[model samples]
Target: MIYTLERTQFFTCGLDEAWAFFTNPNNLATITPDTLNFKVLDTFDTPEIYEGMIINYHVTPLLGIRLSWQTRITEVVPRASFIDNQEKGPYTLWQHTHEFFAEDGGVRVKDTVRYAMPFGVLGTLVHKLIVKNKLREIFDYRQQTLEKILNYPAHD
Candidate 1:
């Protein structure tokens, strides 16, 4: 039940700006929908998020039922790329890689996530029925939010 979700976004901002936005936890809240109630479980300073850093998140993927998520950052190359793996969550194993590259006078941000649901057969069924679509919705919202944020002036 391994699955990979690949997405790419081109931003008008340079590499430094793109890196800053992606690394800053505050930006996550802005992009995430209020419905998910996405919040940082780790202290801002404690999860200084370098390679091998572990971070936790709590969110309700469905109506009123909350899920606790744990992920470890396995790789980091400053502005170039980073990879995160889910240690505990709804997934059996989830590995996500975020890559940044200069492109078309701006920057290209690419995300590749390989994952498997929790239950042997039931989880796979749930993923195909609901979880997969929810994930896509979350990313779609994020993409639009990022486009708006990156297009605006930084000081604004």
Candidate 2:
């Protein structure tokens, strides 16, 4: 079964500023929950995100069990939006789209994720028992962290 999750957040920042921070793959670790221990395998010196870009990372999503995930940037539109599809990951299918809009003197960032687990019926049961809540926790952490990161004086 395929599942979807969407979250939106507004920050008092310009479009360019929000675009730069969100597009940079390096910043992903900062917004992710510490318990997940998300780490990128490759170092990205440039903040420019482009189509065909591949990111490799490992994350401890549940029970301290580390899973390596690889995603490809399939679409990008500068400060507007980008879509990434999982090449290799825990999910049977994982596709996430990050979108940004300039609204009310701030940037409204939204994320839409469509994913599916493995193991057929067992996967559905597992998602009900674990994955759903875990995803919520992860996104909640991201929202709270971004609220802090995007509004502070240190934000650049």
List model 2 lDDT by residue over 30-119, tens digit each: 989899989999987677779999999999988889999999999999889999999999999999999999997688999999999999
Could you estimate the TM-score for every candidate?
0.90, 0.95
Best by lDDT: 2
lDDT string, candidate 1, 1-156, tens digits = 788888999888888899888876556668888899887687766423588777788888798889898888888898899888888888788898889999866899998989888778888899999989998998999899999977645463
- Give candidate 2's whole-model lDDT: 0.92
RMSD of each: 2.9, 2.6
What residue runs in model 1 are displaced by over 4 Å at the alpha carbon? 46-48, 152-156
Estimate the TM-score for candidate 1: 0.90
The list of candidate 2 runs beyond 4 A from truth reads 152-156
The pairs that clash in candidate 2 are: none
